[model samples]
Target: MRRTLDRLYDGALWLAAVTFALIAALVLVQILGRLADRAARAMDLPPPGITIPSLAEFGAFLFAGAVFLGLAGTLQAGGHVRVKLLVRALPEAPARWLGAVVSAAAAALAGFATWSSALQALDSLRFNSVSYGVVPIPLAIPQGVMTLGLALLAVALVDSAVTLARGGTPAYRASEARTEADTEASTGESA
Candidate 1:
């Protein structure tokens, strides 16, 4: 189960990376197309008018998808900003409990977000909503991706809460510990 969950998070992260790469590739192509037109004009030839239809809209949608898809992976990787002063100050037992409580609360919020996003996706699907662009991209597609990302994030937070409640170090905490150890090793410090 643990391995499966880790793979799921990793897969989402990979997909997010691919999505961003696609965006970059598309932008590069668009830029190249513009340069081609410019070169043609400089040569006293007719311009090719090679412009990406609704490039801005496509970029925006892909950007949104990438951001949403990265949420769970970022949480698992300890990339999310957390105020750890209180947790670090407390005794081990109290700190564990506090972490569990906080994780649970965050999981609840993520769950709510997942629900709301799913609803929005469904509504868009029902209405057959499309973006106001040269290419009629379905609004539901991006909304559905957002919903999936929120669902994964909620699962990750719940996993953290459960692990903490069971007196185990959650993935994020373990990641942070590894990072701290690496930092200390490099600086010749011990804690």
Candidate 2:
């Protein structure tokens, strides 16, 4: 039973990663298209691509989507920058416990927010709310992607907390992988 749920955590993290990449690609396409248009305009020609999105709005959504999806991986890897001074001073067990508790709270809050926002975004899309532009599309469509990222973050957090509570170290935590990779690279060796 626990294992089934555990899959959800890791799976969600993977989902977020893929989603973030997709959002980034979407944003990049929009940017390049605009740049092409600018180059065309300079040459006294029509913009190559027709504008279908409010670049500002879609860009914002892409950012939100990336951040939300990336948070779980960030948290797992201890990439979340915090004041290490205090935690580093504590004994090992205490440090671990404190980290677990804080992470649990953070996960809960983030998950709840994402779930709520997703629902609202869905409703907005249903109401046929279209953005004003040359090619009008519903604002809620892109927001839905952001919502997916946030929801995944929450799932990843819960997975981490549960695994820690069971005395299982999350893959992202202080692991031997970093040192091993460094040693191999230093020795000009392949693993």
lDDT of 2 by residue, 24-106 (tens): 67778887888999999999998899453665655565566656656656665666666667667999777777767876997
Those runs of model 1 whose alpha carbons end farther than 4 Å from true positions after fitting are 189-191
What shift in Å separates residue 112 of candidate 2 from its native position after superposition? 2.4
Q: Which ten residues in a row have the lowest lDDT in candidate 1?
A: 182-191
Give me the candidate number with maximum lDDT. 1
Candidate 1 local distance difference test against the native: 0.94
Candidate 1 contains a number of clashing pairs equal to 0
Estimate every model's Cα lDDT from 0 to 1. Answer: 0.94, 0.69
Query: Which residue pairs clash within candidate 2?
Result: none
| Total clashing pairs for each candidate | 0, 0
Q: Please give, for residues 25-51, the per-residue lDDT of candidate 1 as tens digits.
A: 999989998999999999999988878
